[model samples]
Target: MLIDTHCHLDFPDFAAERDDIVARAHAAGVKQMITISTRVRKFPEILAIAEKYPTVFCSVGTHPHNADEELDIPVSELIELARHPRVVAIGEAGLDYFYDNAPREAQAIGLRNHIAAARETGLPLVIHSRSADEDMAAILTEETGKGAFPFLLHCFSSGPELARVGVELGGYVSFSGILTFPKSEELREIARTVPLERMLVETDAPYLAPKPFRGKRNEPAYVAHTAAVLAETVGVSAEEIARITTENAFRIFSKMPRV
Candidate 1:
């Protein structure tokens, strides 16, 4: 069985056929998925989606792009919402200098707040990092110094240093369809360095679809493609990659029930 540890099921892209999309994931061997949150205000929509699907779970927190808008959301609020039975993680939050959609300061603040919530709730923080690797690593290192908290670097596409730091800090690294892109040889090299026990796979769907399906609307079902490439990159069998990543997902998102 495979688990898509990151996706956006609440987005309108899947509205017309959300049921079918989920069924396709199951049919493709993706047994579980976590519909990630991008805005704390839209958490109701995220939660409703998770509530609707027995195998779908969710996280609570804002994406860095919307950090400015939700800067006022306290760590307590995130902790409270995460208490829901279906909420398995704390965020899709982190730095995104590539977009700079929100103020960098606001993004940093939001990230720290989410980290605090993750610490308090014992839920893994689903981090979304982009070109801000240095700052992201700095914050993660500083925060971890205060007290350790579980986190996963979702959709990882950063430098080797960030990947190294994440693993050194005892965090998991989740790869998206980006891993399957022809030009991602550098990324594949980075993946080679990360420990298999600390690696995960996600689609970050409605966005990055892997090769053979690139330029298409991605869904959880396509996660297998990324996993295949990851397995090949890390010199493991397809089934072994699936087993290793699934186990890593369960370990980080411990809040989710095992199948």
Candidate 2:
């Protein structure tokens, strides 16, 4: 079974047919999914979704885009929320220089706090980094020096250097539907270099749908397409890729119960 390690099931895009969406994922062999958190304030809603679906899990913490809005959220609060049985990870949080939706300093501060929470709780931090590889790499390295923490560079589309830094820091790398794009040869090459054991696949729906599904609303079901491309990129069979990524998912999101 494949695990969609990162997705936003609480988003309105899935509200109309949420049940159908989950059913499709199951039919597609996506046995599990972690609906990531973008705002600590809305965690109750996210948690509600997880509670509704037996196969779904959740995370707690703010996204970098909304970091400034939740600056008052302490690491202790994140730790407390993560104590929930359904909350399996922390923070779709990190630097997002591409949008600059939140102040860079605020994003950095929020990331550090989330990292601390992950370190303390032994949960994986679902990091969302974009157009800030240098800063991302520096912060990850600096934080690891403070002490190790489990993390996944979610929806990675960064340069090879950042990928190398993430792997070297013992962080897992999750590829999104972007991996199936025709012009993503560079990303595929990076995937080739990453150890299969440290790799994961996600859809980040409702966005970045893979290949034939591109421009359509994405869902957990489409993670299989990315997994197929990752298999080709890494010289493995599709079944092998699914097995490896599912294993990697449970390894990183250790709080998630096995099926």
* TM-scores for every candidate against the unseen true structure: 0.99, 0.99
The prediction achieving the highest lDDT against the true structure is: 1
- Predictions in order: lDDT: 0.95, 0.95
- Residue 176 error, candidate 2, Å: 0.7
- Please list the Cα RMSD from the true structure of every candidate, rounded to 1 decimal place: 0.6, 0.6
lDDT of 1 by residue, 1-259 (tens): 8999999999999999999999999999999999999999999999999999999999999999999999888898999999999999999899999989999999999999999999999999999999999999999999999999999899999999999999999999999999999999999999999999999999999999999999999999999999999999999999999999998998998989975
What's the TM for model 2? 0.99
Steric clashes per prediction: 0, 0
Native-referenced Cα lDDT, model 2: 0.95
Q: Which pairs clash inside model 2?
A: none
